[model samples]
Target chain A: MRNSFYTAGFSEVMHEVKQDPREASYIYTTTACNSPHRGLSAAIGPALFGTVKSVRALGVQLADSTGGDPDGPSPMDLALTGIASCGVTTLLGGGSARELIFDGIEMLIEYGAPDGEPGQAVRCRLSVDGVTDEPLMNELVEQMQTYSPNMATMIRPVPISFDCLVGTDESTRRQLTVEAEPITDRRPAACRVRWVSGTQLVSYPNGRRMLRVDQPKQLTGVDWGPNPQEYLLMGLAADVADQLGRVAYRLTGERHLWEVSTSACEDMRGLLLKERDVVFLQGVTCRVVVPETLRAETGVEKILTAALAQSEVRDLVSRSNPGGVSLVLGREG
Target chain B: MELNGRTAIGFEEGRSSSAKWFDDLTRVRFAGPVSAHHRLLPRELSPETLAVHAGTYEDPVTGCVGTPVFQTSTFLLDDASYSAFADGAMRDVPIYTRYGNPSQWAVQEKLAALEGSRSAIVTSSGMSATASTIFALTNAGSHIISAYDVYGGTYNLLREDMPSTGREVSFVDPNDLAAVRAAVRPETQLLFFETLTNPLLKAPPIGALAEIAREANALLVVDNTFLTPVNMRPIAHGADIVVHSATKYLAGHSDLTAGAVVGRRKFLDRIWAQTLRFGGTLEPLSCFLLERGMKTLALRVERQNANATEIARFLATHDRVAAVHHPEVGGPHYADLARDDYRGFGGVVSFEVRGGDDAALAFMGRLKIPYVATSLGGVESLVSMPSNTSHSSLTSGQRASIGIRPGLVRFSVGIENVRDLIDDLNDALNGE
Candidate 1:
């Protein structure tokens, strides 16, 4: 009377969902912030930490290129991990729906680089055990491509926009708006993979720092870590700082000390309003302080402009890159 | 992929591999009952029809009308079953009898159908059902409000056992809606009350208490054992969960000890998990007995209701009987609520003899037809004194405060010919 996914409890939920589709609708929220204290580094370094709240709060940490933490993963690392994990989860769910029995599955995701390098395709190879039917495995992999949320997010460009408040000094400020064009033609990004069963992470990279995210106190959040917006601002500040360090190093023989502070204006009304014509944040503001010692450098103005221009997270926030998915299979041990 | 009970074929031999990969195969998921018979009966089906047919598992191979007793500990594992375990949804897949069995599924469907609930779980005993429901719904620091006069086992669980585990219980008079409301705390997570109180048969206003529970954002768990689903369906009156000592009426012949919990699947799933942890799973044989016994539930209860009503009337008019307590005899504080809410006033009746404990004992000793025993709700009449039986643990002062007077005799009417029962009662009263 019971199947893999069509459980008794699930049937009840299905019945309720059938009565009201809204019962199945859910909105997921994650909050994040930068690490409280920056580690000692000669160059610009920042660690972004956040919590992913669902039934339980999970801490996620994203280390920038210059500020990598031994326990923390970089943004590319987390994103790739998410893609891989989500792929396995989606595959298992879809296979169960179709009544396919699989003893085990090992997926390998190969991508060109952590950064979205042009002309490199995302490829996936799955090693399956207990089932020899290649066609069914291919069908399941196809379903995984269609059903996985992270896969779909990568395969199609997500709309992104940014409003920024920039200041070279404490007293002066200016606002700028940047909206990235949506990609009409999509090329798939290389895939990432993981193994999962139940709620446990069966196979994962060892010894990574976890970023914790939670709701605000009003929403029963423990205030243990930052909310999602704080995480975005945190990452942005670090990325800009890293870029500034690079630009300064390129111009001068030594790394210069600099401080970057970031904030965003969030509208509660926008969150409460209808989906259309509503914006969660009015804009994000980043203020950069150039050391008095470096202020006298001839190329200081150009370095500041170039740092903001070359920041990877800045480009990520201001643009769209739709990724794609591919699949391969092998024998399981 | 054999259908019989066994561990997975290929994965069983590996203990040296990653434990995480093989953990799903080792652990059993309590997915609640999965049965095709569930919800097959229409909402409008009469109790009589539901009792007989709602949960009957039909064998596809033999076309057997009855549920086959799946008397095994575990089930064979295949791809579909492995998928079930991997997804944490081993329900109805029969991974282990403790997690689920066709026999348990059959009875659970019947109970759910009878109670008009989304699902039901069968436990080893009534206390198991009650305990699991309480522990599952409330957290460590949570508060519970229950009747002071609840079943001795439940009262003991709350009063004696629960406090050690950090749950505070406040015993309130179920009739006092205002007191019940006042007892609610921000931490209160559940309100536990019996539909009809044991020994006294006091009828709590279920609808009003349900209202209080809602306002307090607490779950209303009613023990519907006395009324069963035949006399009253507590869920219809807004009870969030209903527990029953199926050892009594539901399994009317008293051949098996079992408990049932009926509620929304969400709550029942949590309770089912707790039951598994508590190790209160009924074995396959007992499940079979309980299922077979429940088939005639409506028929047995219909007769007990009528028989008890007549005995209550007879006791009310007797000179030797100081008082008679039955909902039909207008003894409960909320007689009007009982009249309006219940289809039948149930089978138990209690009365106080004129001369207190000694006289009551002598009269019970003189009875010919009924057995002088502890439990109730059988085909044969059974009688007991609360002072010596159910309430013996309570202090004299505690007993007096709750109106458990010295001579109170609890009578569980059976489905016997009323004329003979009345004659025996008359003879016992005469001290012959």
Candidate 2:
């Protein structure tokens, strides 16, 4: 006997075994599937794939090979890629998404490794570019934080475990293991690695390297206090390059090598101690080595002037104290 | 009243006309050779001498021979055409005070000339200038390589705030050329440090750092706050950008807080745009004060430098002093960088007192002339214990690793009578 039942705008029992064999079989199946229109999936899937493919295609090869593992990108390199890619993608896709036009995009990334750490200890820099409107550009940059995958990864702290081994001799072996808590607090985390012989390697997860005993030769004449403002340094340089490049391209329709190099010194003690409010004394020196042809067409000073005037990050880091509280921690032997 | 035709004609038509008055004022204040002074001086003079003379324009109204304070906040335009001039649509026109005023431009011109930079922009405070520069240069998700030890405010901005915006920073030792080179990736943008560090007084080897930064294709930024341009010119040593916390030494009076970034015109233009948008421009009155302060900078800094050197020497020999960290006093090998990068020793000295924090604080309390305060680069001497004062926020372990002991004292020497200063220090250290 066949029976009919109605449930919330649908007929359940109407699909009886003999009357609706296919519908009953579908309901009984273990695997559930909801199919979309072929045309829609095909169009949307390709567009998404194309967007990601375009981003990956724009990668630039780093010239140096020492900082990271030989086989893969170092944390610093990954960070750079992450920042650059996020900026580029956000600027490009963000503008298209919002129905705006952007002539060009430029980004710069900078970071520092902490003492006794194999990866980046400090990460700071700026990203500046010309857009249609100043306010709109700022809004896009702000919104990008919510969407940038790489940036999201950086803000979330990851659990880190370290395994240290000493002695080069095959027969001799010593291992030290330490696990650090997730870095939720903004204060610098001081961690100590005690060498079996009582040698201490102090590491600040968020602070910079002041001195290293293993590499004492490199510590000569360095002021450990006035270190660089990590992000500001990169921002200044990148902005300079961007401005110079824009001027050059506008004037000559060609892109030239526009580079900036920056460095600073800081008193390590002041940063680590609670006495000095200012720690690193950041300094940036840029040499815009332009092609001779472009240099001739656009006065070097003029180009440089435009570049300096155009830079925003240089103005910010050089202007005020971006606010924060300082904290100190102790590592015991 | 008798109507005199001759006098009326003279006043209204020819000799005493409004045109004549305008022409006379223009000749004295804005005529050919006088207006040319702005462009010519920067090109012809050396930075050291220019720092002293760049903005000493005689007052048009009073002939004061010093840059006068134009305290007005707005300017009256001559006609409706001035609207375009005010909005940067026209060049070389005086329009609004916010865009550019005579007083502000005078200081800007002086700073640019003194730094031997293409141009410069002034801001309300040191940090504002720094922030403007950074904002102009970078956007979200950029990379930078920085020295490990940095100003606390800047450290926090980079470490905590910048990451939220997608920017990343790496801190490394400036002295480590290999490390600096290693730190640079394809997207690395800039490197930064100070010419002479504050409090700790460590000096970086600019030449080597510049070389490393160049190889990595990054811009080098030098903070000339402590040393001032009088002691060191980072540009001459291959710096791309130079910044100063003018509140400390450049202003000399402790009255005004200002900052400046000096670099090539191309880069400065970007910074200028950011400054305008951010509204961090230095007021005209502050610019006048800065100009006034600059006139005596050479004299004040010279005396201050001498005083600091003397004090550093005195502290080195003191029985209460354990170790002095002045770059000049250290061995040739220890401070070889000072010889290469700096022309003179700066006015900051860091030393460890014999006693710990309690005794250090007591010594500071005993001092009469030197104020026991925070902030350096004032005309009056200042002293403070780092472990308890400047770096008190840091953890004890962090302090120990960096060699900041509880007994450490950072002294900012001023241009006061050296004999009296020495006597005050002696009494304090001797537990008077």
Q: Which CAPRI category fits model 2?
A: incorrect
Report the Cα RMSD per candidate. 12.2, 27.3
- Alpha carbon deviation, residue B45, candidate 1 (Å): 1.2
lDDT of 1 at A243: 68
- Candidate 1 chain A — worst ten consecutive residues by lDDT sum? A44-53
lDDT of 2 at A326: 18
Clashes in candidate 1: how many? 23
- Per-residue lDDT of model 1, residues B1-432, tens digit only: 345422222222211122211111222222235544333576468899999988777776687778888899987767656655654455546778888888888889889989988688999999999999988776555688999989999999999878887689999999998899999985677899999999888999999999999877678999999999999998999999999999999998868899999997667877887899999999999988998888989999999999999999999999999999887778447545647688897789999988999999999999999999988888889999999999999999999888888889999999999999999998998897
Clashes of each: 23, 155
lDDT of each: 0.65, 0.50
What lDDT is reached at residue A244 by model 2?
56
